[model samples]
Target: MPTKTKSKIKITNKKVVQKKNLKEEVDVRTPDGGGWLYSDIVKDHFFNPRNFMQYGEEEKFKFNGIGRVGSPACGDEMVLWVQIDPKTEKISQCRWRTFGCGSAIASTSALSEMIVENSGMKIDEALKLKPQNILERLGGLPNRKVHCSVLGDKALQSAINDFFRNTAQHSRVQTAGAKVIDKELNVTDHDIEEAVLEGAQNLEDLQHKLKVGVFNKEVIPQLEDLLRFYNEKYYG
Candidate 1:
């Protein structure tokens, strides 16, 4: 009878799984078991959030531009409001509200500070601010939490777009690679693609998701065609 040979198991340092509770919320700044997930600045910002909106204070803020993103149903939502100096066109003041996790609060808090820093950032300069810049200033978030850092800039850009539209400065609106589909609402193919991917399947569903053709009934056909193309490409 042949002797049975046992297979040897090999383990590498990088593949080592730390024995710890995955359910517990570890300190992001200090490593508990999962290692440092956030930097010192992120910790400070999360603990002492700045320019955050308090309850019943929504009406008190006098803002010229407003931007909102995310949804509470998805477990994260952020709203950013800005006051632009008429003379300087700089972000005079910025306030925010976030209904999400620690990272979300910290990112928005950091953004508010950066915006109002140096006597407020210029609108054009502020619009150029990207997620990478915010992440770099915070000393970088963990790979999984990186998406949280994007919320601040997205909201800020949306607010800027609102400001441009409100001031009749349509030339300043940054489409971010989106081609305009409806001139009235500034609805773009990118917006429609995003809405469809987010689960808006029909004309009514798309309207509910993006308000794309709500006002301009004439654009319904074009909107529908794009929606169908995307749905087929992605889902079919």
Candidate 2:
């Protein structure tokens, strides 16, 4: 339950549950002669999962996208939803729903909370999460269970990737719309693009310009030169 604090903590390392017919893929070792779980961080979280994935139907937040990761049969799928404030590029809301062992739940819970606490954390930052860090907070994991705990961070990264992918696809929609608008305005593709590029340049220069107006005498001369040049070549 005290999953919020992961900065530094103690772990009582012990296997809370035994896997039926599971092979020992990894051997737990420490500075001493091949000791297993010299510390006990895993057992604590297993008994009381700090951030087990649970969500209400009526959760509040306006988010840009949602992402889910992991295999269901693996029994560890994490769903993450994030809401961003467009004006400030800040995370207005972040939530995670996870299914797995205590470590999985706590890791997810910790990760989501960390993101919410960070508020403006980018997807890149979220991807850096590791199971060791999560275990360090609770205490430490039974050396063998490290892989199981690592799933939480992996799922979080997958979910973050999904959210960004969706966001990028949504962003591309505007370009499609612009092409349609170009047709409707009776503007050639190249002509509209050139105009847009020029407009952007004008906008960039506006900050430094002493005078601003479409009809400004000095600006009009530059416009005339552009018009004449285009008329003589591209327009003809």
Candidate 3:
């Protein structure tokens, strides 16, 4: 008799995940209308934030500048300087010099903190997020500042692209680890790592985890735990 071979199974039409470590109370569609615009974290950081402000010629960071956005055309000039961690492929430092309103200043400031906190996130994932996402976490942003919200997204992307163009080799690894967000499409290595760590049996499990949201440390384990608990409770 001939020995039979086992057929391996595969997952199909898996839901794509975008943006990582999003806020649970995210209201993308309705978005805060006339309530507290930002969260305490934004307020705390915007007030003081991490590290020093106002980079100069003799500053320690000495940003060579990976990317710069805006000009007199947009009524502002934004410049981003990124310092990558040699080993972790993480953003060790993010500094932006922008000339605009408080929204511009506040939004950029909040963005720096987010990048530092979520070092594992990819540039795309980080770019996909709006300043309002940060503003919403704080008490709130003035309506006029809404425009500045997207600036953070654009500026970060420009900086990321600069990182890719200027230094493409290792950045590939960083690009691979971005988070999934609502309405996001691109996938990277970070996604695979997160999914595997989450113990996601299928794409559906990963998508569900994205809906609820994630954080820095428990990026994968949190999803995995949910899957096990959910399966035992529902599928069991």
Q: Is candidate 1 or candidate 3 better by TM-score?
A: 1
lDDT of 3 by residue, 1-236 (tens): 55586547765888876443343443222345653345445445556645434646336674422545454345765566777554565666777766765456666777777776755454546666766576654445555556544366666665664455345332342342354332122323333333434355654666553332332333445445545654454335
Per-model lDDT: 0.79, 0.48, 0.52
Per TM-score, the best of the predicted structures is: 1
Model 2 residue runs over 4 Å out of place are: 1-61, 86-90, 118-120, 169-236
Query: What are the models' TM-scores?
Result: 0.68, 0.45, 0.47
Native-to-model Cα distance after best TM-score fit, residue 154 in candidate 1, in Å: 0.8
Return whichever of 2 and 3 wins on lDDT.
3
Ranking the candidates on lDDT from highest down gives: 1, 3, 2
Q: Candidate 2: minimum summed lDDT over ten consecutive residues — where?
A: 174-183
lDDT of 3 at 130: 65
Candidate 1 global TM-score: 0.68
lDDT (10s digit) by residue, model 2, range 1-236: 66676856678797777442223333345678666442344444445544333455435545565555554455666666676554564555676666777556666666656666755665555566666566555455545556655565554554443344345532222221122222222222222223332332432343132122233434444444444554444333
Quote model 2's TM-score. 0.45
Off by over 4 Å in 1: 1-36, 189-217, 222-236
Evaluate residue 2 in candidate 3 and report its C-alpha lDDT on the 0 to 100 scale.
57
| Native-structure RMSD, model 1 | 9.9
